[model samples]
Target chain A: MRAEALLLFFSFSIGIVTGDWNILSYTTKKRDHHQHHAGISLKNYCESWRINVELNNIRGFDVVPGECVGYIGKYMTSTQYKVDVQRAAEQTTLFLTNNFRLGADGKDAWIFDIDDTLLSTVPYFKKHQHGAVLGCRGATTNSTSMEQWMEERSAPAVEHMLDLYHEIRARGLKIFLISSRREHLRDATIDNLVKVGYLGWTDLILRCAEDCYHAVANYKTEKRRKLIEQGYHLWGIMGDQWCSLVGHPSANRTFKLPNPMKKAL
Target chain B: MRAEALLLFFSFSIGIVTGDWNILSYTTKKRDHHQHHAGISLKNYCESWRINVELNNIRGFDVVPGECVGYIGKYMTSTQYKVDVQRAAEQTTLFLTNNFRLGADGKDAWIFDIDDTLLSTVPYFKKHQHGAVLGCRGATTNSTSMEQWMEERSAPAVEHMLDLYHEIRARGLKIFLISSRREHLRDATIDNLVKVGYLGWTDLILRCAEDCYHAVANYKTEKRRKLIEQGYHLWGIMGDQWCSLVGHPSANRTFKLPNPMKKAL
Candidate 1:
């Protein structure tokens, strides 16, 4: 393995010093097609964009790039998406198996974000051009549309999250479902979560009318702060959005599910 | 655009429900050529692994997956890698251009992680099988070997980071480079930074001998805590490793550079 790796490294470095590397030929040939702006194929471009979004490098974009709409649509519905989310879930399970030492004091807790983490609203996003036309948190004008969709309570459990949720619960951790959904949507949220096999979570916290003005990160951060103040040791926070997982007084660990449909703040 | 996206979404959903979609044909064909595990192409698997690493989903990994060495070798040397980093740098530049109100006080500062964020240590890793063998932080018995390489001071500036560094400097924000390299290597580290077109910074902080026992995250977080205590308002922190960016008292914003070479804890 070392020999093979060293050979490739030398070839690459030599190619860099001299501009005659055939390894670059593949990308160059694809660039000539000109279907995309950069010579990168749609697959490579969208994948890189998704990585950037996941890394929290790309932020505050209201909509998905128009050029990547189809790519994102296909990716969200692809086997690769299922594999990615499952892998993240697997990592969480592995961490629990290997690292976490649960306290018997009953103060141990785990936080799970609702949208695109517990329940997937991809069906809604599918109609909205996969976050090209409208996203869940971007425009207040779309709030009515988003709430109506939530009220339908038909959103499916994200691919592997239900299993992971059950695993966390089985381990005797208190589960908190903190969401950016408004307080008025409480009934619909519970109904959807229950219908999708998420039962008996400790609390389902949502945004009150007063909490609506705060950014999702700040609201969630405040909720976590209150939880920590209540003497709960947050073992982990799981979410599809960076805003859900980042801020002061962060949990001991965080599990980020894959989401190309939307970036929530 | 919406029509195109809708067509793809419908096709994918229909395929998911009925189990017949031509879009899967491309991936299926690629999967047949399995020189790797999971029936997934080396490119796809390595890319996903790299994304998981960047997202902090994959943790405590000591080396690159053996099967992925070739794929990672090619990717690190590929135009795609350069484009990915350049795109991140563009986002930072765009952020500074639009938002970010700088204070007249020099206390408004930006923090940069030294290793892959500013200097490309790829040359050293290139000889180390691109981290299939010795990673910077994972194996400290490698200190002598790593220090000797650092002392050579021949490492190049990571593409685009030098420009971003200069941009932040021109904006008059005090810059701090907080690195995980031990204090013994400070002279070598400074030499490499200077030799690679990096000049002038508010401070170059390194881990002291007593600090070597602390994990990289804790050590850097402590450094950041001191900076914050000293009244330096951290405007942003940029790094390739999550350890350099995440934790309490984090900067107001963060920029994550793409680094598949190594994941430092």
Candidate 2:
């Protein structure tokens, strides 16, 4: 009976060890998906619901050569609106610069996402109540002034946050802005980032025309890998979507701030 | 006074936010280093403190084309002796298989460090008195029974963890065993992994004589990039040292188990 008890005790110990392993593994797997998505993408994904950009015909918008304007509409145009696109952009910048280690080590870099992250072009479609507003005949072609639109459609950067960005550049970190805005929106997006006090960056990376075929995360990862290969240790990354941080381990220590206009995306 | 109160509140909030970001970034950075070194080179680095292998002279040893053995002395060797190496190997395996989503869906793969991770050759070293006996003039020159020299040198799979691997493989996940072990030791290491139930991996990446210049983490990252180019998403990675997981984001999620033999390099 003693011998049997010893054997039983050993077996029970093994069972406990193995059981712990399985539980830990399951918990970890669940956490991987959770952490990868976090809450950052939830708001963005919901906002995407209002965006009816044809996944296949993203190019038809004449994004290049044609001037584009961003508008924040005060309407519930889609079932997926979670945050107002304008407020989301302000909160993203404030949260990232204030919370992350930006402009450190004299290596200036900034990673940004296009779409609702940087511009609120979603308004053009909502005003027309459709996804293909730009492609529609007779759509207004003249782009609105970014400064005026920012004041009218979005909240300006909080005073302290703008000051913080100035402080970042004063430290000598060369800033690089990365985005998935597509090559066509490059000129307008750069103009917007500059008008909004993001003029310190050294370079801006926009998504190539071919990037439409890849997942947003994959595109961001490849861009980040290229940046690292070019010998830059990015100090900060900001995006309204989790996809922006996919390949950036250096900037994984991120910050998420509340988007006050949580219903108008 | 009202202005002062508001200023104070904002300052306090900014302080808290900045402090939290710093702590998170530091913790993740440290974890990155830990995950980078959790493999064969970690063991080799530890071993280097005792035996220096001249990379240039490794070819000289290859000229003999026979069995080579290294023996480590008693448990109490020097101040560098650590009792945690053995425990770390077991724990690392458990942590890796549990936390990372490692299944085929072509979404992830693992690069394992061989030596201490999959096999404990320290027992053989101890039996041979830290390679002193084996290093003696005119040691056996042909293939010797690795299992026979030291009974403890046998590579034993962490039993409960096999299910995790089987699960990974069943889901189509690829596994690669990377080692800094000499090219001559390849067959022995492979045989050990097979005997210990770690057979049927996607690839076994080893350090060639010409590939010694780069740090282990750099080497692993380059290899991982190639795998990624091949369309594999690296969701999980494991190593016993800081250099093995350097370039991958998953390295931040590495687990460090207790090392039973804390040999230092």
DockQ scores for all the models shown?
0.19, 0.02
lDDT of 1 by residue, A1-265 (tens): 4324433443343334322211112222234443323344455555567667877888777778876776677667654565567668777998889877789889899999888889988788777777632223433655677788989999998866887898899898999999888888899999999997899799999987888778888888899999999999999999888888887778988988877656646
True contacts kept of each: 0.29, 0.00
DockQ of 1: 0.19
DockQ of model 2 vs. true complex = 0.02
Write one digit per residue (lDDT tens) for candidate 2, span B3-87.
2443354334333432111001111111233231222122222222212121010111222111112112322221112212322
Candidate 2 per-residue C-alpha lDDT over A1-265 given as tens digits, one digit per residue, 9 for 90 to 100: 4324433443343334321110011111112332312222222222222121210101123332111111113222211122122123333444455655643455546554433444444444344322322221112243233223433434233222344345546656565666544566666566666675656667787666777556556666777777777777666665433335434444633322111111110
Q: Best DockQ goes to which candidate?
A: 1
Number of the predicted model whose TM-score against the real structure is largest: 1
Expressed as tens digits, the lDDT of each residue in B1-265 for candidate 1 is 5324433443343324331111122222244433322344344456567667777888767778776665666566554565567668777888888878878766888999887789887777768767632233433555577678878888887776787898888898899998877787888888889887788899999886887777778887899999999989988899988878877678878888877667556
Docking class of 1: incorrect
Model 2 misplacement above 4 A: A1-168, A179-214, A218-242, A245-265, B1-111, B115-161, B167-175, B181-196, B200-205, B221-265
